[model samples]
Target chain A: MNAITIEGIEKSYGKTVQALKGITLNIPQGEFFGLLGPNGAGKTTLISAIVGLVKPNAGEIRVMGCDIRKNPTEAKKYIGLSPQDININNYMPIGKIMEFQGGFYGVSVKESRRRAEELLKYFKLWDKRKAGRYQLSGGMQRRLMIARALMGKPKILILDEPTAGIDVELRHELWTFLKQLKEKGITILLTTHYIEEAERLCEKIGIIHQGKIIACESPLKLIEQHRLHEKAERSGAFQFVRSGSLEEVFVALTGRPIEEASKKSGEEKWEALPASLL
Target chain B: MGSTTRLAALVQMEFFRFWRLLRQTIVPPVLNTLLFILIFGFSLGSRIKEIHGFPFIVYIIPGLTAMGVMNNAFSNTSTSLHMAKFDRSLDNLLAAPLKPFEMVLALVTGGIARGLLIAILTLAVALPLLKQPLFSFWLTLYFVVMQSVFFGCWGIIGALRAKTWDNLATTQTFVITPLAYLAGVFYSVTILPPPWREISLFNPLFYMVDGTRYGVLGVHDAPLWISAGMITGLAILLFAVCVWLFQIGYKMVR
Candidate 1:
């Protein structure tokens, strides 16, 4: 059985922006999946649609066999989403934040606190439990979000640019944490700009361009097939000379230069989708 | 893990949030009520000894208490929701397994809690200081809770619709403040001549104030049944509106 099944999902903002255009995809249970795309390419939109955050104009999404539209509560129980910016309730103490997240997922206080203790210590955030949001650094904040997401003990964990603003050391630390989650039989869906990170962590990668999935395959398979070779200036515009790295495969496929994302791009695009437009 | 427990957990977070900012949330309003008791109730009371045969100082306590309840309830939900929308944190709540009605109820419940707390604290201080007692405890509780529910739901509507800070403030400034003030907070509506008195009747806050005064002072200008009906109907109507708005995702999602 698949961990997630998305069937012909479409989303439009107001009348002009059609964020997702009939996206259909699936991730098998326990698979480590990576979703990659350029700015405005609809990666976040697709992820949001899967998690039941953004309602699609037309489609069906089933999470662990529960239909997101018809059985949202049951579906949501199976998934824990670490959005690009979940925006921690900055005022609450860190410990309370985790418990509150668990409560939302119907985890009892005792159970939530137990899980909170384990995850916080595992994430190296235990000592900071009583700390305010401002006390944590960017990397610690990102880790807190991931730790909070795990409070539900979800079967499928979805991370949107989880390692966005962290330093190389912290990014590696988060990668280790995520790898641990994957080890525990959790189906992982990650979206990130670091092609190398996806290459190292994902079993399968899906590249979305202009609201459509352009490529979906194993990282090695995608790289071996594309086999970035030097091309002329007009290899149909935006396409660059072949480079061996998966980043080159991404640039080659999307026809856009490497975007200054991770730290900025994903969040900027999210903000750009003005509330007034809805 | 039950639905009710889940709802309480969510509502408890709001209380925690308020406590974290206690100086800003609790102290200011309670002090504002005390100041009004000193400035408007007593200082002004000396100049004008009575209104409707009650001491001017005592006559204004219920209105001030109602004002505190209404404003706190409105601000709690409005500011919280607006900040969530602004920071894009609303996605977390939307993604939670809780139903739309549960989410709405939790937020409204937080509003009610804050409203009632302020009402109780304000009354405790003022009633004892002035040697006043509740003419009817249940009626006072009824009127206070109803007003909180109405404004709390309105707060959600305002936060969802507003795109900017100024946009959120527009309604509070232009609509709620004016209506609250003119709705007989400072004086009896029945004392007004002709159409002015009739105009005051249209404001919902008038019913809240008049009803509260009747409960506190055993005097009211409007019929109790009509006031009761209007407050209950408006509160229920707004509660339904908030629930529908949450389910639809309204301006929170595209």
Candidate 2:
């Protein structure tokens, strides 16, 4: 059975700019799924709709057989979302932040404290539990967000650009931690700009472009089946390479430069376009 | 999470933040109220005789109490909600499983708590300075609570609608502050000339102040029951509007 099912999801801002245009996806339980897209390709909108942050114009979303719109409390119980930015209560102590987050998810105070302690220690934050958010280093703050997301022990974890701005060493450390969750059989839906990160962490990948799913398959199959690999091989552009990487496949499918895909202005640019293009 | 647990968690976080900055959140309003009593109640009262069968100092106690409650309650929610938007911490609540009404209730609870705390602090100061004892403690308490809830809802609306800090400041400067002062805080409406006296009745805070004054001094400008009914009706109307705004995610989630 699927852990999350999104059918005919549509969202718009006013009469212009349809953010998500009839998106449909099904992520099976225990699978590691990656969603790759350009800046304005509705990745965040889809995630927001699932969490009930933005009400979609039309769609049906279910998590573990509970409809997100009809039974949000039950549906939300199965999922945890670690958004791109980490904005917590800055004045509170780190220990209190985790404890309250646990309580927000309905854990008893004693149980929440226990989980907070366990997660903090696991993230190497136990020593700094008394410190406020301003006292922590950037790397530690990012790690703290993931620790907080895991406090509820959710069945499905959704991470949006978790490693976007971190240094290489810390990024690898986070990758190792996330690997353990996959080992424990927690389903993960990750959205990322880093092709290599998705290739290394995800079992299956879906590429969205202009509010539509352009491709969905395993990394190996996607690379082999893409036309770029055949053309590159025939034209001797990558003569010594054994096979095209996921990055090459992504660029081929989206037909846009990686730099252009990563720009923050892309969202605004899309919004400024006419509805016909949107 | 159960709705009850989630609501408890939200309110707990708000209280924790409030207590963490007790000096900033609780002290200024208390100090301001004391200063007003010293200048207007004592310094000014020494020259002026009794206006409403009570000394000028005693006549203004309920007005000052209502002012403190209304201002503090309004600030608590407005500042917190505005900061939540600026810092994007509201994302935390939005992503949670809480219903819109629960979220509104949690925020309103924080505002009312802060307002009541300020009211109590000011009342403590007033007890020693008043010329006569308060007439009915329960009635005074009721007006204080109602004022807090009413202004708390207004605060939510201000925070939700304000797109800039200047916009918020303009509202306080041009709207709320003027209405608060004109609500018979310093002098009785009986002293105002014809149309002005009639206009004072339109300001909701007038009813709040008059109701509490009747409770505190056993003298009031309007009938106690009419004042009570007006404030109660306004509070309920504001509360219903806030609930509707929250449910629709007005100027918030979208």
Candidate 3:
């Protein structure tokens, strides 16, 4: 069964700003899927739509073969989300937050407690388990959010920029933990600004820009395809030249210069990877 | 089976969330009501004498109790929603297998629980200071529960409309505060002239306070059934609106 399937999904904020535009993709069960895009490429919008947070103007989404619109509760049972903003209540203990999240997913108190203990330790937050949200550093809080998401034992996990503000060491540690989760056959869908992360972790990547999918392929295959096309265009004259990096390929496909794409905005842009790539 | 179980789970989570923030969730309102009783019930009761054939302190207790229930109910849902919005924790909930009705029920019930707890706590603290038992125990309990549910729905309405912390503050200041004070917490409607008394009848909160006071003191400015019917009708109306908002994924989840 497909873990997630999107068909002609469309969303617009207010009347003018089209956040998502007729996006369609299918994620196989247990696949590590990466939604890659520059800022304002509608990555979060697509993720939010699939998670049922934002209503789509048109189209359908199916999770584990259950239509999200018609069977939202059933679809949601299999999904867990760790949003981009790590905003938990600072007044509450970390353990309590975890318990609350677990309960929301129908976990019994005893089960929630056990899961919290295990996840807190796995995330290296056991020592700070009793601390209020304010006591943890930024990275620790992000980790705690991830742990909270995992508390329900969801079959599908969506992480939106999980390592955005974390340090290098912690980022590496999180990636390792994520890999372990993937190995257990949990279907993971992640949106990240870090190209290297998508390169390393994603088995299949979909580069989105301006609410459209520009490319959907294995990372290595995408890079190899672009290399072959470039070589063919040059007619063997520049065969000795080093192949272009993913960053270069991304820019070439999307048409937004890398420098301009990296600039921060109030809302992260995830527009279709420039139409040029397709 | 799916809906009921998920609803129950959401309610359980809601309570857990409130328990975690007990200091903010449960404490302040009880303390505030206690102080109101001490200052108004004791200090002012000395001067005001009796307002409705009962000591001033006893007369105001039911109103104050209703106020406490309303305030807690409002704060509980409003703050929870705001925090969810700010921390993005709501997204996790939105992604879950729960329906919008389930979420609304969880939040509204959680608010009611806190409201009930604060009402009980305040009553417990006020008991020692009372000159006598204020009203029939069963009627008082009914009014308190109804008032809590009513205002809890109001809180969800406010939270759904609020986009920022300041917006919530504005709701409390402009909406809840006016409703509480104007609901006749301090004085009887019999003392008011014709036009104002008629206007007071329009304020739904007044019925909540009056019905609750009638329940407690057995003396009421409005007929008991009238007040009860009004409150019940208003609660149903507000609940419908809240449920609709939840179904559409209105401001709360989006």
Candidate 4:
């Protein structure tokens, strides 16, 4: 069965601002799906609707065949979300916060404590278990947030910019951890501005623009199609070899440059050129 | 329904949260009430003999206890909810299996629990200060529970409506504080003139205070049964409003 099914979902904030305009997609169980988009591209809105935070004006969302509107509790049981902002009460101890989050999902106290210990150790936060929230560094807090989301061992994990502000080493560590999680049969839906991360992690990718899915394909297929189109557009003999990176493919299809692409360093920029030319 | 389990879980988590914040939640009101009793109930009681055949100190004890309950109830839910908004941890709770009713119940019950702790602790301390017994044990308990539930719902409503910490404090300042002091906490409404006495009757808090006083001193401006009936009616009304707000995912979850 599909892990998540979104059929004709429509949502609006007030009356006039339409956030998700009839978005529909299905993600199979056990696939690492990447949702690539820029800011204001409806990535967060779509995730919010799927998790039942904001009610959609009209649509249906099913998690493991359970409709969110009709069976919210059952549907929510299969999903976990690590939101973008890291916001937890600073007065409480890290242990207490974990217990409270586990309890919210109906995990028994004894079991939750046992699982919390394992997670804390895995995330390297075991020693800081008794510390108040404000004492933790930013990266440690983000890891704690991820640990909280995994309390129920959910089948589908939704991560929104999970590594936005972490250091490069920590970012790679998180990526490796997530890859290990996918290998253990957890379906992941990730939204990120980092195309490199998406290219490295996801097998299937969907590019969202202005509240709609503009492109959906396997990474290899998307690259090949873009190469074919690029070859067709050129009339004169091309000096440069014919190869297109994900960034090139994205620009070719959307006609707008990726905002984050500009931040690439000089050496990295040279490396991103077509492998055929190199 | 799955909502049932989720509701139970949320309520349990809220209780845990309150327990963790016990110093902030429980200590201040108990101390404040004790201070009020010392200054107003003991120091001032020497000058004023009796108001309506009950000792001045005895009559005001129940009113002060109710005020403590109301204030704590208001503060607990309002501060917690507003903090949830500010910290953005509210998204975690909102994304869970719990429904809106479950969320409301959890917060209101947490508020009620804090209020009850303050009321009981204040009464324990007050027992040594007053010469006369303050209440018929059973009635005092009833009034405390009902008052906590009532103000707990009010606190949730205030929290949901408030956008900032200032807005939360504004509600307490403009609405809860004035109504509480004006609700016959110190004086008997019986001595007030014609229309003013009737106006006092319109305030729901007056019934809570008077009813609690009746429980304690057994002498009240209004009949004991009337006070009980009014408080029960108000509890039902407030509870219904809270439930309706939860159903629509009002400002609380939204």
Candidate 5:
């Protein structure tokens, strides 16, 4: 069974701004899926729709075989989302936050307390467990978000820019932890700006451009498929090139150069990544 | 999760925040009630000795208490719901295994909880200071709780419909404040001119304020049956609207 199945889901912000056109995809159980996209590429919108934060204009989404709209209570039971924003409650202590989240997922208070201790120490936040959200540093807050997302022991984990602000050492540590979760057969859907992170961690990658899924392939498949197609330069002194990377494939598929966007107005230029490029 | 367990956790979180920010949540209304009691009860009571044989100071306590309950209940849900949107913490709650009615219950309970606390604390501070007697305990509790729920639902609807901070401020100033003032919080509607008094009858809050007045001092402008029926009916209707808004995810979509 698929962990999440989104079928032809369309969302529009207003009359003019179509945030998502028609997105159809399925991530099977226990699969590590990565969604890579530039700014305004509908990755956040898709994630929001999956988590039921945004209602779609059309089509359907199912989480763990339960319809997200019709059976949202059951559908939501399987999802653990670490959203892009640092939206944790500043009033509650870090430990209480996790324990309360655990309670929402049917974990007993005693078991929640035990898991909170274990996860807090693992995330190096054990010392600051009593502190409120504002007391934590940026990276610590991000770590706390990840730890809290895992508190429910959810069947599917959705991480939107989960490692965006962390330092290199902690990022690697988190990667290891995520890999261990994958080994334990938990499906993970990750969206990131870092191509290297996607290549390293995700078993399959989907690249979205302007509200459309442009490609879904493994890192190696993407590399091998687009390797020889990169434009060759005969006029300049072209050096010997090795195999291509996922970053190159991403640019070749979706990126629009900045010089053209410079011709538009400031506002249009700001939105040119997926707007003018489309 | 069991539905009740989810509801309990959400309600607990709401109370936890209310306690965490005691200055913002609990202190302001209590302090406001004290100031109102001092200025209106002491200063104004010197001139106007009695209305319907009760001291001017004693006459306004129930109204003041009703206003406190209504305003606190309204602000509690309005601010809490708006903050959830401003900070995007609402996504977490929506993603949890909670039904729409559950969310409504948890949120409305938060508002009711804060409202009832303010009512109790206001009377605790005022009754002894003014030396007023409680006429009907059950009736007082009914009006307090009903008005709390009424304003609580209105707060939810306002928060959901508000697009900007200005919108919420506009509603509070033009809508809620006027309703509370026109509800006869400080004076009996009998003091108003004939037409104006009839106009005030249309204000739903009049029933609430007059109900509490009747509850506390055994004095009322309208029939007891109408006030009780109107408050209960309006509260239930507004609650149903809130549940519908949540069920449809109204005004909360992209």
Candidate 6:
């Protein structure tokens, strides 16, 4: 059975803005899956729906075979979501945060404290357990979010933009920690902007564009398909096109150039593509 | 895990947050009650002999106590929920495996805890000055708990409906505060003339204050049964509305 199954999910914001248009996907048990999407691409909305924060207008979601809408409590027990932003109680200590998170999932206080200590020591936050929230650095706070999410010992972990804004060294450290967690037979779902991050970590990548999944395949398969298409396009005389990287495949699939995102100067460059590319 | 365990955890966290700000939460209400005692109870009350059979100071103590309980209860839930929304931490609670009633119960528990603490503090300070014999402990406890629950539920509704700090404050400022002052806290409506007394009878808080007075002082303006019935009915209505709101995710989830 799959770790998560989303069938015909649809959500809309306000009157005209459709957030998720019949989103459907399946993540097999113990698989590292990545969901990539640009801003306003319904990534957060989809994550919210899965975690029961936002109710979808239509369709159903199941976590480990428990339907979310029908059996929310049972479904929620199997899943943990670490949202993109730090939405923790800022005044509480790290240890207390972990304990409360565990307790919210029905762990006894004594057991929660024991598990909290273990996780804190593993995350290297044991020394700073008593410190205030402001005392922790950005990287430490992000690490705490991961620790808190794991407090429930959830079978499936959903991380939304886990490594968005941090230095390279810290991001690498987090990646190493996440990979270790993945090795423990935990199904991990992640969303990130860094193409290389997804390429390195996620075994299956799903690129969402305008509330629809445009491509869902292994990174290598997506790169190979994009390479063949690029070769087909360069048949005339454009000789020196490098083999398409994950970034190229992402840009080609999403129809938004990464270079255009990087350029600070305001010049509208890309126009509407053919309906086929979309 | 059981739903009871999750509810307990949620309540414990709320209490932890409340007690962490002990000085801010517990001190202001005490001070406010003292000011009311000094200004109205002593100054104006000293000039006047008595409104009912009891001394003026004795007459107003229950009113002030109920007022403090109601206000603290309302603020505890409203401000905390509003801050949760402002900081976006409410999503953390939303993602947990709690039923809507469990969530509401936790918030209500936190509010009542704060409100009762303030009431105890008010009694501690007021008992020394006005040495009145106690009437019924159970009655006082019932009225205090019910009044706090009523306002706490109101606060939840306020927190959900309010989009900004000012919007939340508007209910307290424009509606609750005016009603509280006019609800026979400082002076009895029985002393007022004609239509004003009839108007004061319409305020729900008047029954709350009068009910608490019956419990504390063995004196009441309205019939004891009716006062108890009115406050209890209002509490039930407010609680039902809050539960319905939570179940529907009204203004809580988009």
Residue B207 of candidate 1: its Cα lDDT?
93
Q: Write the per-residue lDDT of candidate 1 for residues B1-254, one digit (tens) a residue.
A: 46876797889987777777889888899999999989987777889858888888888889999889988889889888887776666888888788888988888888898999999999999877557679999999999999899989999998888888897689888988889899898999878998999999889999999898888888888999999999999999999999999887898665
TM-scores of the candidates, chain A only: 0.88, 0.89, 0.89, 0.87, 0.89, 0.88
**How many residue pairs in model 6 have overlapping backbones?**
0
User: Alpha-carbon error at B45 in model 1, in Å?
Assistant: 1.9
DockQ of 5: 0.65
Q: What are the Cα lDDT values of the candidates?
A: 0.85, 0.84, 0.81, 0.82, 0.86, 0.84
Clash pairs, candidate 2, are none
Candidate order by decreasing TM-score: 6, 2, 5, 1, 4, 3
Q: Give me the displacement of residue A15 in model 6, in angstroms.
A: 2.8
Highest lDDT model number = 5
Clash count for each candidate, listed in order shown: 0, 0, 19, 0, 0, 0
Give candidate 2's fnat, 2 decimals.
Answer: 0.57
TM-score of chain B of each: 0.96, 0.95, 0.93, 0.91, 0.97, 0.97
lDDT of 5 by residue, B1-254 (tens): 47767777788877887888999899998999889888988987879958877888888889999999988888888888888887777777777887889888888899899999999999888777556568899999999999989989999999998878788889889988899999998899998998999999999999999999998989999999999999999999999999999888887655
- Interface RMSD for candidate 1 relative to the native interface: 1.5
> Cα RMSD (Å) per model?
3.7, 3.3, 4.7, 6.5, 3.6, 4.3
Q: Choose 1 or 2, whichever is better by TM-score.
A: 2
Q: lDDT, candidate 1, residue A151?
A: 87
Error of 6 at B178 (Å): 1.3
Error of 2 at A90 (Å): 3.3
Q: Write the per-residue lDDT of candidate 4 for residues A196-243, one digit (tens) a residue.
A: 898899999998877888888887888887887675644322223234
TM-score-superior candidate, 3 or 6? 6
lDDT of 2 by residue, B112-178 (tens): 8998898788888789877456798899888888888888888889999998878778877898889
Q: Find the 10 residues in a row with the least total lDDT in model 5 chain B.
A: B125-134
- For model 2, give the TM-score of chain B: 0.95
> What docking class should model 1 receive?
medium
**In model 1, what is the error at residue A122, expressed in angstroms?**
1.2
TM-score of 6: 0.93
